[model samples]
Target: MKHSEEKEMIRDMARRVAEEQVRPLIASMEESDRFPEELVEIYGDLGLLQMWVPEEYGGPGGDLTSVCLAKEEIGKVSLAASTLCANNSIGLILPLLEFGSEAQKRRYLTESAKGRIVTSVAITEPESGSDVASLRTMARRDGDSYVINGQKSWITFAKQSAYMLVFARTAEGKGYEGISTFIVDCKTPGLKIGKAEHKMGRHGAPSYQVSFEDMRVDADCLLGPEGSGFKSCMRILDLNRPTVGASSLGLAQGAMDQAMRYASDRKQFGKPIAAFQAIQFKIADMAMKIGSARALLYDVAAELDSGDMSRLTLLSSMAKCYCTDVAMEVAIEAVQVHGSYGYSTEYPVERFMRDAKLNQILEGTNEIHRLIIARELFGRR
Candidate 1:
């Protein structure tokens, strides 16, 4: 869990921004499920928006570990803020850096680093959540363009993005190879963005249903080779899942911090709850879980930053699954320690509990992650 001086600076900067800037917006966002429109520019200015993009493209040239540190610190204050940072950095910027053509990277990265061309990745459909091969969206090749037609569900920030990376079925194949990704402009004629979902928490980062009714993008818009999109995404997610773990770790830590503070001050039976062995045990367990999960997530991130993919999938899934489960447990215990005040919005634990649930569901449900982990375990033997 030790960090370099540079990374320590990055974490501190993110924490300051979260407490001073992001905390002020949470109430409004939770009140109305508002889109975090203001966060994009703030993240961009701070270089958290595209932390992994190289410096040649007018970016900060930071790595994924730096991004994770930023996410964890920011997450302690706002899951929505952390989610926004992750989605843009992992979902779009990383792909563009790894797979985009030179011209595409120059254009997109420059725009993105400037916070001008906000981005979203569209992959999931109504029928396809964990099953990427089951996607029904079609992008048929035409003379000079491809016409895409299908509906995408739960596309985060689709309405706010100027450009979207849309994955669709481009040919007939039994496996993931049939799919392709197109960088479609959101203003393209046949694209429609629907209303955002009202989730239990993280309302600031909106997820919407997007429809592509014959939406056309030029031939050059296809990212990487034809039919390589799904595989490339699998590679990216190997990096992404662990970053989600980082966010969850922050949430668990934040809740633990709050619980400790409350237990130290709140009195029961003419004494503070901190004096009670039961409350002390709960706090002890929370700290233990958070510490272990942090160690795992940080190690996974460091391994990834070293450019080693041999253990990436298994470790990433473990990080995602374990950290999120820890977050859920810690959030609930933090709530329990608060007694009646926990259920009320008086303390942030209620919001923490609500937000903690979504981390388990996002980046693939924990059930799906377990299957993946098991599959990898046996497949490697």
Candidate 2:
């Protein structure tokens, strides 16, 4: 699995950016409990904010693998930065690219590529967590506009976004077919962004509750076909899940890095703990799992780069599920390897461990990913 020079360069660039830019912002972001706004401009300057943008749109046309490679580097330092990067490049942009009309693309996509106009997604609700079809949001068509009414919880970067990909039901139904996706301006009259939720990790990347009360948008704001949003939702996740795997891969790698250093330096009975059989065994297991997850994630990303979707759903779910699991496992082991110091804020393994916990639940929860994987296997068409 040899990588192209371009992809490797993208990965290296991200590493440099993470080390130089992200490290300086982490403490401030953690203290403020908010994503650093300056990064939006910084990443935009590097064209790293949204790697999926194509050359035609004034972007570098970086592919899915490039996105993961960069994310793997950034996630090693901060999942908050990585999460923002993914949201800009994958979560919200993919849907627009896939379904948005040319005019829509011209107005939004170009600015998005530049990181000037950030977009957030609104799909999950309090009641319908993982069940997209069961969502209760409604959008009623008026003369030449649609009025929306709903509340979306756990929406990342909603407060800072210029626009949002809001999913609402256009037809009278509780099923997936009735849903439609719309691009709405955040400053629209009836849209209100709620406070960010208190979370266990990635405090800088906060998830907010967004409420819309008769929020109206022009008819042209409709993305793709009306009544096709649920499908679009699935499509976006299919595009997004692998990057999560890549970020999780970084998380696992970061934790292992801490543990490796700790083991080499920390003394036990008489010498370096790295000399101990138990420590060697732990490091070996971490390497084995991390390598396995990376191979699977890279293979999946490469297939996506080749425009192969025959096994997309199955592999994407596997990559996200397995990689996050490995992250969680490795982070815990990293902590254990550090003994008491691992749990303290002085060492980074504790932060990695906290960050690892959130990866399991983001995008699609691991439980939902399992269901997706099982469904794809059993009901493959």
Overall lDDT per candidate, in order of appearance: 0.87, 0.87
Candidate 2 lDDT by residue in tens digits, 217-249: 999989998899989888888888899888889
| lDDT, model 2, position 308 | 87
Error of 2 at 116 (Å): 2.2
Residue ranges of candidate 1 with Cα displaced over 4 Å: none
lDDT of 2 at 219: 97
Residue-level lDDT tens digits of model 1 in 221-262: 898988998887787777788888888888998999999999
Q: For candidate 2, list the clashing residue pairs, or say none.
A: none
Error of 2 at 99 (Å): 1.1
